[model samples]
Every structure is written in C-alpha cells, then in structure tokens.
Target: MPSLEVIDEHIVLDILSSTVRLVGSLLPNNIEVVLHDLRNPECSVVEISSPSITGRKKGDSVISGARRDPAFANLMEFSSEPITYVLNYETQDNAGNPLRSSSAIYRNAQGMPFAALCINADYQQIDKAIALIQQLTASELNPTFKKEQQVIISEPTPDNIDALLQEIIDIAMEQNPGSNRPAIKKANLVAVQRMQERGIFIIKGGVEKAAKALGVSRYTVYNYLDELKAQNEGE
Candidate 1:
C-alpha cells in the first residue's frame, strides 16, 4: 500500500502567510483579513491587515469574535472539516452596518485544524448604490400623475383682409347712415381710416375693393389714406 501525502506544519503556515499577503494586496481597502491561531483561543488574532476595517488589531481574541460574529462563529465545532468557506454571509459592525464575509479553516498534517482565515468585506456602499438605482427605476412618486395640465389656446392673429373689410363696411352702413352728406362723408372717411389700420389697404386689390364698397373712385380711397397718415404723423 502507498503512503498518503501529508501537509507539513512549516509549509502550511508559510502557505497561509503568502496567501494572506496576496489576498491583502488584491482586495480593496474596505476589506479586512484576519489570521487566527486556534491554538490560542484567548488571543486568537495572530495577525490582521486593514485593522481600520474590522476595528481589531493583533492579539484580539477569536473567542470574542466567534461569540458575536454570525459568519465566523462556531469555529470550535469545525475542527474536522477539511476546508470550509461561506459566501454572502451577513455580518454587522458595532454600529450595526452590514457586511459580506467569507471564512475558512485549514488543518495541519495531524488532521487537526489549528488556524482560521476570515475576510470581511463592507458592502454598505454597494447597498446604497443599489438603493439609489431602485429609486431611479421603481419609484412611486410621480409629479405627472396627480397634477392637471391646462393649455390656454389663444385666438389667431392676422385676419383675412378682404373678409374683414366687408364686415367693417357692413357695420358702418348699419350704424345709421344719418341725414346729411357731411355726416355720410364723415362716416365713409372714418370707415376708410379703420380699414387702413386693419391692414386692408396694403393688400392687392384692397383700394379697388374699398372704392366699390364706398361707391367712390380709387382716388378718393388714396386721399382718405393720405389724410389718416398725416393725422398719425402729427400725433
């Protein structure tokens, strides 16, 4: 029968130390790594990197950590397991902020586990980012939902010159074409001045149409327009 390969004591510790350095270099600043000496439970934290993250320094007891750490607790009962690792395990700090962590136990040549390596990664920032994304995508408060939109469409500008000119002539005639020629001539001059302001005289055929509407020659419309311009310039 062939003898089985066994891990040496010095080799195991050296391998673990190198692993600690490699993982420590690769992980971000928010992550922490702690090496526990199970043989010294009362002071199990033999080494720690990023002490600011876990709030622990070297020589801190593993017994205290296992007592409070949900992910790292129960280490004493895991002596027989060749290798154990947990993922996405919930861990909370002193202020109750959450973390994601993984831990493992490695045994020596004697088939007795003597050490533990744990990694605690703070995921509070990630959780905050996820919450913001949720707010952007699945939010319930919508300004467009409860408020009403009102549109006040105004009346159009630029009336049709011919149609408006006819209407104005009709209105002036109906306003009592009273007894004398002076009164009738006054009415006609007033009507022509109003049409010029209404932009009618500036259009093609407007002077001819106004002459016919007043039963006068186009020259008379021109005279009325000149008089209105002189009055405006004097003002």
Candidate 2:
C-alpha cells in the first residue's frame, strides 16, 4: 500500500502533484489525472492533466460533486472503514462522455483526508471500436452489454460560497435527529454536530454559517463545538 501519512495539507499537495506529472506522462491521451485539495472544496483542483477530458482546470470548485459523492463524504466524516481508495467507479464529463474513474485518498497523521488523486479515463471511443469490430466479424451482439452508469458531472463552481454553506446547513438540520425536536438547544447542538461530522467547520466562514442557521451567535457555535469536543474526548 502507498504511504498516506503527510505532515500537513501542503505536503499532501506536493506529493499528489508529483504523482500527477509522472502518471500523466505515461497515461494515454484519453486518461486524465486530477488532484484535489479536500480541505478547500471550493477551488479544490490544484493540478490537473489532460484537463480537456472534463473541462476542469486548476482552481475549479467541486463542492457540488463532493456533497453528492459518497466516497468524498465518507472521507470527510472519517468513516471507520479501511478504505484508502475508490476504484472502477463511473461518472460522466461536462460533454457527457463516459468516464471510468478511480480516486486515491491521501490522509494526514490523524487519518483525515486532505487530498485526492483521481484518474478519469474516457472510454467512449473504445466502446465504439468494440462494437465496430463485433459487427465486422458478423458476431452476434452481446445481450448483456453494460449500460452507462449515468453519473452527471455538473458545473464545478457554485454562484458563491455562501450558497454552498447554506445548502450544507439545511441538509444537516434536516437529517440530524434532535434537530427536528422542540428543544432549541438540542436542535442547535445536533445541527452543529452534524456540520462538524461533515467537516463544514474546516472551511472559512463555516462557523458563522452554522451560527446563522441555528439562530445563535458565532460564539455560541464555538461553545457547541467545544462541548462536542469534550464529548468526544470523554468517549
């Protein structure tokens, strides 16, 4: 297994950038290598090779995809599974080309993912070639050809960071148990804890957004965080 322990987030980027260059040179033109800084979902694409494959360049934001992708969400939540990478998954590019994809996650000493190296291979041409070869040979078409996985890659960047934060807060409130109850303190605490687990607080202005969603001051949000920290330590 590849070593995943990096001293900090910047070093993780350095390691992934080197990988992008080395792998990019060897891979075919249809394959693209992209490195993401997970700590900053907005403008997370720090490096990319064969950018034309996805129409995503450096400084592209993938917050929408990050929110939707279970692999990314699990990494942020520090899931207990021993997963270091997600392989052979499928997604589509901006132009709707079929992409067979895999992602390798890089983590810090504490096992929190700070970076990801993704390889996206556009295989539409290969599919067409296979079909043509079969037809030319007079072979019967395979009855069970795999269908497209249909993962849509939307526009990377949102209109603004605030919009993304608000969306996250709304999801947290809706999903967490205590958040729906009548007790305001319990509801707010649950909301804050949900945000914490999803790693919202890692982003700039995250605390303020949580405070606004809970109808409290930022300091109150801090207190909630401190309380959550104590609870974790106690456990």
Q: Which segments of model 1 are wrong by more than 4 Å?
A: 1-5, 64-67, 109-111, 125-235
Model 2 residue-pair collision total: 0
Clashing pairs in 1: none
TM-score of each: 0.46, 0.53
Lowest-scoring 10 consecutive residues by lDDT in candidate 1? 152-161
**On residues 1-235, what C-alpha lDDT tens digit does candidate 2 reach at each position?**
4444425578668977998988899888788898988777677888888877777778876542222244544445563332378787766564445577787777666666668788888887678779767665553466555444455555443444566556655655565545335555665777677566444675556778777766789999999889988988999
Tens-place lDDT per residue, model 1, 83-154, is: 656665777553445666778866554445577888878776567678766665554565343323434342
Estimate the TM-score for candidate 1: 0.46
User: Using lDDT as the measure, which candidate wins?
Assistant: 2
How many clashing pairs in candidate 1? 0
Pairs with steric clashes in candidate 2: none
